[model samples]
Each structure stands twice: as structure tokens, then as C-alpha cells.
Target: MTNFEKLLDEQLSTLCFKPNEIVEAAVVEVDRHKVLVDVGLHTTGELKITEFMVPPSVGDYIQVVVDELDDGEGNLKISHNEVMVKQQLDDVQSLVENKTTVDAKVVEIRKAGLIVNVGYLTGFMPKRQASIEYVEDFTSFLNQVFKVKILSHDQIHENLIVSHKQYLIDEIGGEIARLEAPVEVGGVYEGKVTGIAPFGLFVDIGSHSTVLLHITDINWDLTKAVIEDFKFGDILSLRAKSVVTSDNGSQRICMSLKHMDMSPWEKAKDDFVIGERFKATIYKIEEETGNLIVSINGIPGVVENKDVSWTRMTNSNLNNVFKRGQEIDVVVKGFENKMGFESIVLSHKGCQSNPWESINEKFKVGQVLDTVVTSVSEKMLFVKVEGDVEAIVHVREVDWINPFEAIKSISSGDNVRVKLMEIDSSERKVSASICRTTEDPYKGIVAGTKVLAKVESIRVNSVHLSVLRKGKKLEATLPARYVNTVSRWLPSGEIEVGCELNLEVSMIMSGILYLKPDNSERAQSSFGTGDNPFAEAIKAALKF
Candidate 1:
């Protein structure tokens, strides 16, 4: 072409390459100081052999970056270490971006986590993310190699973040049956202690699921178990007890270290004497059920609320009265699992003297005793005697005037005197009366006294009245035998309140005023067992 075009072509052909550009180089010759690599240049580029993690042989190819276009000898300056670092950074970036997995080796153990070597850089794996299970001892994992997923990374600072838990999730997936077959329940297996809780020990049984050695299942005598007794990393021979499938379909394993031996359950059955007394050590007081799990003669037993006291103390109150490790006197009652405990049944109050004993000698019928009202029901008053004896006062015996009102008036814990009506030691019952201790309200009232009465309330066969005699109002009831003289058997529903009655009191017996027509001859006659038409009619009515 032209003269200038010919000059430009000669200069362009003489130029070698740009600096910092990555280029693939092949080793042509190796020396002690440097490696001679040809990068398709006129003069071969040189690299320090020390820059390589592994020394290359002749004709080996490696990727390198151009450090300088010229090294004063017309050879290009290149670095294998620098390009290798850059390539690793690119790989770490890809791992971080794609969230991929890579094999890692634990290099150092830190209090917070683990320092691991992944690819060409070191990354931190936090203690919580180091495993699917809790990691209390990191020394077990030192120098251990496992796969991990990149959590975060800083290429500028050469810092990498990884998680062993994430790798386990993606790898193991926690599918116990799919990943590995779980151990058979009731079979013995070797387990390692991973954690220690106050109530139990968390064990690693080589299954994908969890295995726990509960405190209650640790030993027959539960008073000796504490988390401090065991150390982390202690390997134990545990027998699998139960395997429960959770709602999420994962298996939860229950193992016991004590089950490796013959359980005391077999030997305990022959040791119980049905009525013998024993000092029991309380172990666990269940807060929800208030059931006390006790150890008696080194065997587990249960004391229900019913057996706590003859007074029927509730299980809820057992929590308030008893605590773990407290000793109580009890008797071997029986063997039953009524309260969800399959052990000897014990009664705490059975060892004490029965309050019902000698009850007849302490108080006889018609004897007045100072009592405390324990409870008031509609028809009965439950009272407690001085020596923890229970006595009941029927509603009819509460008051001669009004018993319904007396039930409301007598509250719990009220002190009152009661006359014992019946004291039967065999039945363990004390029948009492409140009004019997005092004089009858109808005392000294004559049977033939005439009174102005008013109907207060009617019953099925009698009309109850309030008699105002000499300015004092007194309760009275018309005898059903004499009600027909004025009422002709008045159906109680048709009777009205405040209905005035012009009648003479034929009799006042047992706090009831027997009423009759003032004009009837029977009203004027003696109301007793005599040859009167009224008494004869009463006999005829009774016979009917």
C-alpha cells in the first residue's frame, strides 16, 4: 500500500501483550528458582516456583495472570499464586451466589464456632450452625471433615461463612427412615452424651432422630439423679425403651441407661406387705396432677389424694403440703394403677389412728359436744368434732323454727354445740342435732290456748301458720288430721298467703300448733289418747 501503512504494520507486529490479563501458560522448562512457561509469546514468560502450591512438571499447563509486559529480558512477568487466588475468589463467589455445597475441614475451634478450610480460604461455622443437634463440645469435631453450604462471604477480605447444619439438612434431610434405619426399640445400643438437661440427658444413638434418657428412667431410685453427675462426651450403653412417632412423622426415641440391667419392677412385687407401715421418700410432685411419686423401700409407689388423709384432702392441696424429698409415714395398701402409676399403692393417713375408734365411748346419744361446721349443704351440716371426728346434722334437726334458714346461717368453720343423736362406732357415723342442745321453742305453750293465726305457707297435707301469741310471733303447723275441719283438704296450690284463720290451738306439740274449728267439740276436748271423737277420728285416720 502506502509508505505510512507499511510503517504501522511493523510496530503492531512487534508488541507482545497487555499487563494483568489472565492467560493460559504451558511449562516448557523448570528450574530451582523459576518455572519457564510459554504463553504463545516471542520470549517465554517466567514464574517463581515458590508461587505454586504444587510444583509443576515439564509440559504442565496452568492459568496465570500477566504481572508485567516485560521483565527486561523480553519475557513476560506472570504469577501463579495471584491467579490461583483470583480463581478461588471466583469459585467462592459462585458458591455464595448459588448457595452450593463444598467439602470443608475443621482447622480451628473457637468458642463461638469453628474455623474451617473450604476451597483455598478459611470460613467460620457458628456453633449453632455446626450441626443438626446441639454442639457443646467442639473438640470432637476438630480436624473432622464434612460438607458445608456457604452462608456469606467477603472476597475483598477473604472471609467466608458456612453452615454445617444447612449441609446436613440438604444432605440428611432429617428423614430418619430414608436416610438411615433407626435402632430397634427395646434393643441395646451405644450412645454418646450430647447434652445434659436437668430432667434428662440428650444422647446420640447414631440415628437421625433424637434419643433421650429421662431422669425418671435413669434409675429405680430417682433421688440420686442430677445433670452434674454426668459429663458431656461420656459414652453410655443405653437400652432403647420406646420409639414414638410424632405428629410431624418424626421418630422420638426414649432410652434408659438403667434398663441395661434387670428392672426392679419384677422384684418389687414380692416385697410388699399389704398392711405394713413404711417411711416413704417423696421424689416427684407432679404440678399438674399433684400426684406424688414416692420411693418406698427403694421401690416406686404412689400416694393419691384419697390416701393422703381420711378427711379427703385434694390432690391440688398435696402440692402445698408436700415437697420432693419429704418423708411421710404410709402403709402398703395394695397394688393398682388407678392413678396411672403401676406400682404399690400407699396410704399416708393409714398409719395414723382411726378417729372413728372409741367414738361411741367419747360421746353417747343425747350428749352435747362442741363442734365446728366444716360445710353446709341443703339437707346436711357437716361438722368436725374436736378429735378430727366428723359428725353430720340433718337439716330437720338444725332449727325447730326454720331449718332452711339455719343452713344458710351456719357457715364453714363456725363453732356450734351439737347434741349427738346416734353414735355408731361400727358405721363411723355421728348423727347430731343443733336445736336439741337447747330447749324447745314451743315449751310451756298450752294445748288448749286460743290464738289468732294466719296462713303463711301451705304444704301438700298441712297448712303452716305464724301464730302471734301475747305479742311474740311463733311458727306453727296445722296437723294434717285436723286440716279437714276448715280446709276440707285444701289443695295447697289453691291456698293463699296471709289467709286469716279463726281457730283455737288444739295442741302445740313438737313445735307445730294443731289447728281445728273453734266450734268443733273436738277443739274443746282434751287432745290426747282418750274416748274423744277427735282422738277416735285420728285413730281411724291412722288405721286408714
Candidate 2:
């Protein structure tokens, strides 16, 4: 060996390059397989070409790490990949300690999380921390770049975890703060609907904050309000009803769409006048109460069952008379407000002209007119007279003998002639007699006529008898005095049913026949047959 060569060997040994030590080297030669670099030592270090992210040009400075002092090829081996990895570790540690965000590229998708490359270091993002919304398919994130926050970083354990959801939350926090400051109760704002739930609609008021518009506050009618009426991204004008703070210190916003307009009841008095008639649409009928809820000029009003009609038979069921969407004439009676709610009382029957008005001028006693039977009850028959006027035919006035059988013989929609007997305007009642349309049988009977009658019923002081006159059965009351005078004519002192009696008409007044036994023999024998003794006795009894 030469003396200068021996000195070079000793100088190279003094450099003392150790394994895993980082050093800056100058590239001397770039080759296909390896890049030769000068580390300021007598011997040159060679780095694999694959380790250089961007292939280094000759004579360029590059960082390298010592892999071995000698690789048995008379050269020192170095690695560029190791130097890049060490630099990334230092950068990631700084980000974790400072809680900073950096951009990461998704490299691979795993069932539990995503593997991303942040600079030269690989990081793992758990499935739960992927995004603000639930991620079902992680592969959609492949090759996508997102801003991420470092959740943990441990270079020794090689644990580097990052979260994309944390980054989104931090970004939205600034917008939330800006929105919370200006939003106040009772303030109106324009917003867009973001989500729809069964209970309400979620609206995104400006500044990325979402508020709830409950179903009840959406419209005046809750039954007709439906979720399908609204859709996502619908713009609406809303009024903030309340701002509530939850137990978690989070603010909840309640908004309303109905408050955007004035209430109908607030202007009801000005819109409707008492006794004024208007056409109204029936919107709903309460099944339980049978009250009709109608809309008059878009204002809701109520018509109770009693106010539905003038007749008692029609008022019993207002639900069946009025149906949804049916338009009918109604008169506004009055308005009442209770418990922050207003109710308008209306009547459908009052909208028409009163039937009792000028009743005396239109009808007179003993006036016979054809009428249709509207309804029949046990005690009376309801008949419709002129112009929606209804008159009642009482059971007593229905027939002279069997009032119950007469009522049963008549039915609704049957045509019959009735005579007006009484008119009461204050009570709005008209009394009519069906039998009075014909001649009264008692009026035709003379005082001396003798007829046969059957005892029907015996009362405390009177005995009722049924008599046949002109093929019509007539009821006659025989007073106790008359019954006592004819006691020998009866089988016992008490009258019995179906017992025949010989009766003479003693007096007749007010459609009632007063009867006594044929006393012509006694009167003739006592008065000596002068000018018809029965007639004389009747004239004396009636105070002629």
C-alpha cells in the first residue's frame, strides 16, 4: 500500500457512520437502479432509486439515512424512505399537540375505518369519525382528499388516528355562534326546510342553524294538515315563537308559520254583523257533540244542534242535515271570546223569514188548507203549511174517538187537509185540527134525537162513551149527574165497558155532547106533553 492510500483509509474510518443515523448528502451520480451520494467521507453512499419520491438529479443535495456502514460491496448503504418517514413523524406530532387540521388523501378503505396518507405518514380514521352523516359505503371516500384533525399520534407505537367529523364540527361552530346572536323570540325570518319528521319540519334558518316548525303551528286546521304538503328545500316565512335552552346548554328554536298572518277571529266582529245573513260552507261536524263547524268568508263559526233548524225534529240531528263542503245560508247571532279563543254563534234557521210574522193576516180560524205531513209523533202530527210554516195537529184534535189511532194512521209525506184553530206568535206555535175540516157530528144532532152509545171508559166523575154518527165514531162525556140520573139504565152504579145505553142529546156546546137517558116519558108524564117535553127540559137545562 502507498503512504497516501494508508492515510485515506484512516481518514474514512474516522467518519464513523452509524446505522439509522440521518445525514445530508450531495448526489454525485444518478443511475437506473441506485443513486450515488457523497456524505463528506472518503467512501460514497448508495441509495435505492425507489426510495426517492421524485428521482434526484446528479449533483443535487438530498437527505438520507445510514442503513449500514458497509453492505459487503465496498459501499455505505443509505435509505431515502426512512428519512422521509422520520420527517413526517415530527410534523404529525406537532399537529396533534397543537390540535391543528391538515389535508389527507384516502388510500384504502377498511371495514372498521379508512387508511389515508397525510403527507408521508399513514393515518387511520375510524368509521364513526368519517363524516357528519352516517357513512354506509367507505369506498366512496377512496381517492378523495379531506381536511382532518389529528385525534392521536404515537410514533413509537405507530398509532396515528385522525377524524373528519371533528373538522366539520369545528367549521360549523363558527356559523352557529353567528346565528345564535341575532335570533330572538317573536322575530320573523325567511328560512328553508331541510328535513321532515312525523312531528314537525326541520328548517334551516340563516347561519346554518336548524329550527323546528311543529305540525300544530303550521296551519289553523290540524286534521287537514299533512306532511306531504311540504317538501325538503321549501322556502317559508316563519316567526320565531320561542327560544328554549336545554339541559345540555344547547338552544332549541321553535318557529311557526301560522303566525305570519292575522287570526280570523281577530276581525270577526268587523267582518260579520248580527242578524246579517251570509252563505257559509260546512267544514266539519263534531261527531260527539253534533255541532257544525262552518266557514263564513274563511272565518270559522259554530252552529249548535238547537240552532240548526226551527223544527224540533230537524234539530235533533244537525250532522245528517249538514255535510262537509256543503254551502248553506246562515245568520250571525253573536260572538264570544273565551280563554284566548273566539267563537262565533250562527244560526241556519234564522237566515230565512220568520214563519210566525203576519200569521193572523195570512191564516184565520176555521181556515181549511191542504198540507203535507212532515213528521208524526205519539201526541201530535207535524204538518207543513204555507211557506215553510209548520203547524201541529194535537192528538185530541186529530180524531173525535181514538186520537192515538188517528196519529198512527198519518205518516210523513202524506197529504191531508187541516183547519187552523189557534195561532200563537210569541211561542211560534200554530195549532191545527184535522177533523175540524169536516162537519162536527155534535153540531148536527138535535136536542131531542135519541141514540145508542157504548160505555168505553169510566173516570172519577165522568163516563166516556163512543157513539156512531154518520159512520164516524165520536167520543162523548157523560157527567156523573147524568150517570146518576140514568143509574137504572146501567147494570150497576159504576159504568161498565161495552154496555149499551139509550142516550138523548140534552145539550151540545163547544163540540162536547151532554147526554141523558131518554127522559121523554118522565118529562111527558110530569109536564103533561106540552110542546115536546124533552125540548122544554133541554131548553130549561141550557138556560135558553
Best by lDDT: 2
Model 2: how large is the Cα RMSD against the reference? 28.6
Q: Pick the candidate with the highest TM-score.
A: 1
Per-residue C-alpha lDDT of model 2 across residues 1-544, encoded as one tens digit per residue: 9999999899878678889988888989988998888998536887778776579998898888898878897778888888898888877767888879898889899888999988767889998778754346777799999999999986676768998876865664411234545567778888766556676787667645677787756764545557789875677898877777778867777787876765645667787889899988887777666677887776668888667766443432344346789998998999865422345789987876676677778888878989888777688777887655678888888876566777888877899999998877777677899988876666568786777778888888988887888777776778888776665333234457887677777776655567876765443233212455554554356343
Q: How close is candidate 1 to the true structure, as a TM-score?
A: 0.39
TM-score of each: 0.39, 0.37
Clashing pairs in 1: none
lDDT of 1 by residue, 86-159 (tens): 77887877787787888888989988889998755778998877875445578889889888899898757788
Each candidate's root-mean-square deviation in Å? 22.1, 28.6
Candidate 2, superposed: residue stretches over 4 Å from native = 1-278, 281-299, 304-326, 331-334, 347-350, 354-358, 424-427, 444-449, 454-466, 475-501, 504-544
Location of the lowest summed lDDT over 10 successive residues in candidate 1 = 486-495
